[model samples]
Target: MSVVKGLLYPLPLLIGFACAPSALGAFLKDSKLNLNLRNFYINTDYREGHAGTSKAEEWGQGFRLLYESGYTDGKIGVGVDALGLLGVKLDSGKGRHQGSTTLTSDGDHAADQWSRFGATLKLKASKTDLRVGTLMPKLPVLVFTDTRPLPQTYQGGMVTLRELDDITLTAGKITQVTGVASADRTGMAVAGGRRQSNDFRFAGVDYRTRDNFLLQYYQAALEDYYSQQFLGVSHIWKVTEGRSLKSDLRYFRSRGIGANAAGEPGYQIAGYTPDHRGEIDNDTWSLAFTYAVGRHSFMLGYQSVSDDSDFVHLNQGSLSGDLGARGASTYLIAERLQSYFGRAGQDTQIAQYSYDFAAKGIPGLNVTVAHQDSEGIQSFAGSSLRERETDIILTYAVRSGPLRGLGLGLLYGELNSEVTPDQNQLRLMVSYNVELF
Candidate 1:
């Protein structure tokens, strides 16, 4: 929970120079600046009791500014992208500021403020682009986390090509990541590793059909950690005028790599698995079906993880010194509030229902409820471990007047687990965005 000072000081200087009309030539004329004002609050009540603390709650205000410059007038266009973030603590005391969800702890107390700045250099040529800097990538294999006030960011270089119709190719190398609650960047690691790996490289391709079919494949490797491959497919079939069904399938395979496979105990991941092997050998797959009728949608899914190892993803808890960071996320729908449901030999079933109020003359409003059940976790022997979670979310947006770009969201979740503590969580957020030229 160490906050990096002076990390965002360069942002104001860069903004000052870039915003000057006379300095950037055509870059200034075509640039776009957007600012988001966000207010967030979270409350977590530990049901099993949290060792002298029963609840953790915090509230904060966040500011996110993004500036993107259009490609300069040339065959090989060049531009710069910058991100500026600032978070202000609105309310938090010693007992409630344990860094559960909202704010990072600083010497037994939450920090008063935190800020970060990042910039990207870009080059574009004939529908292809290369960018080297901070990025937030949302892919099947690696998705950035944005569940909190500020989104997570990664330091890396990526190349994207879309020269072919209905297809996209991407590749990147990421060395470090900055978590949502911290200003400092750390090396990448799995759930429980004593060290970090500076090398996390990936490549992928996505192909889509005109008839609403998509296919994807990606491969990634974290040096001395694990090598992972992902495959996904999605298809949408229209049943009638206002009815449709979507089918989504995803799979992942992970195994130890480099030192992780060299029989060295120091390279192994940290977690409970079959026989306490702590190795990276797992296969997981999930399939989901969704049916939509007018403004209503229903979804069901099933997921299975292998019996030898837990599902793996890019996690950095090992770099936090005390191993206290628990803010890891993935694209899996089974990742609930208290658990990822990714333990070895786990099978998960999910159901969801959502409705849009626009059809009922209440535009800009939506509600969703979901439930997930997971069983057969290896951590609990004998009768097999089981966990269940129920979540509800509501969102609304201002569609007119002075608050046209304002939005509000609320979420509530409850978790019951056989091997872990049962808990309840709530989050409320309000956001507004403005464009500055």
Candidate 2:
């Protein structure tokens, strides 16, 4: 507590700056308009465990527009940002289906239509800012999931302060969620049920030193569900001439809170609650290391789960298990594959390898492979879940041609689990990014 208080001790001094009067044109930057264009194509294939269940493949094209308003010409700057997103199904229907999104119906075929718009507002003062409305947050406990045709967004208000050197403070309350696959925004709640909590709340602080060392502390609460705390650290070091190694360590602790735990007895009777105790407490930790040599990079990581269920995902939903799928995510605040971590008492081992074509005189080609294995899961007597996942990624981009920013990727994954369903996937993606000043 003392450490945290010391970090926030500068708030009063920074508040003074925000309240101080400013002369005309003294604190404002001219407003400007920026446009970015993206053309994206994706194809996915899914193979289901049961032959009777529908297997699927899907393809789509999407366009995203982002517009930002320059700060107001005032001491307390104000602005707005509008994001326009549209996804059009290029192929889909009954024999081969894709998703359960409202945008798609009973057919394996897609609706042949495009879905679209979300926006946000901002207010800034000194080194602090408040953002509200359509939001994509990439925080430790909550992350916007965007692994499909569209990007997921949330409805929330958040404040960030960077008034302290090498330190940042963040807090927020969220009310609803907008899924990546649909245009509708649903009331927010815990992932496994109809439970809803008063605006979800969170606060955290992180610091990164000049020496490439990072430290973080965070707490997040979901009304009637759970409250979680996360702490993490990372360091990057040069291991040899022209070679570097990076280490990342992370931990999360959680407990059932309010309604989720107290009322769990009733839910348990209905086969909803999976554990006892008004609290859902578990300890999760991981250590990852990466080393780079010329154009070849290799990473190895290990994680442990001390609970009976998988780690939490804010708005986790089922995937279609389609043909080609890519699970990569962007945005620092969004959830990572690391989020869906464990099923209590489970330990997982991960390995990954990648190569850049730059070493081979192929400017924009790269390849990667990753695998994970987990065990010690909860199951009927004499059985434990043994899941193995393998992923392959291939990417190519134009080097110095007219299509400088054009990029293409092929992703493939296969999952084999003991006493668990089987899942296989494949995905191909193409994208172009253009910047206009």
Q: All models: lDDT? A: 0.82, 0.63
- What TM-score goes with each of the models? 0.93, 0.81
What tens-digit string does per-residue lDDT give for candidate 2 at 1-437? 34224333443343334333352133224423333333333333334455544456666666555555555556688666666666666766565654544233334555664544666677899999999878888887777766565677778899999999999999999887766656555655443444434468999999999999999999988776678899999899988887999999988887766665666532111111243332455678888899998888988888887644445546424222321111223212111223243655667788889999987889899998888877766544333556677788899998787988787877777766654456676766777765432
lDDT of 1 by residue, 1-437 (tens): 12222444465566454344444577666888788889999988889935757888899988888888876666777778888887888999998877534666677878887777889888889999999999899987778888777878889999999999999999999988887777777788887776778899999999999999999999999999899999999999999999999999999999988887764665667655655667889999999999999999999999998887788998776665532233678877688655777877889999999999999888999999999998887773443688899999999998988888899999999988876667899999999988866
Error of 2 at 373 (Å): 1.5
Candidate 2 at 345: error in angstroms? 2.5
Model 1 lowest lDDT segment of ten: 1-10
Best by TM-score: 1
| Shift in Å, residue 66, candidate 1 | 0.9
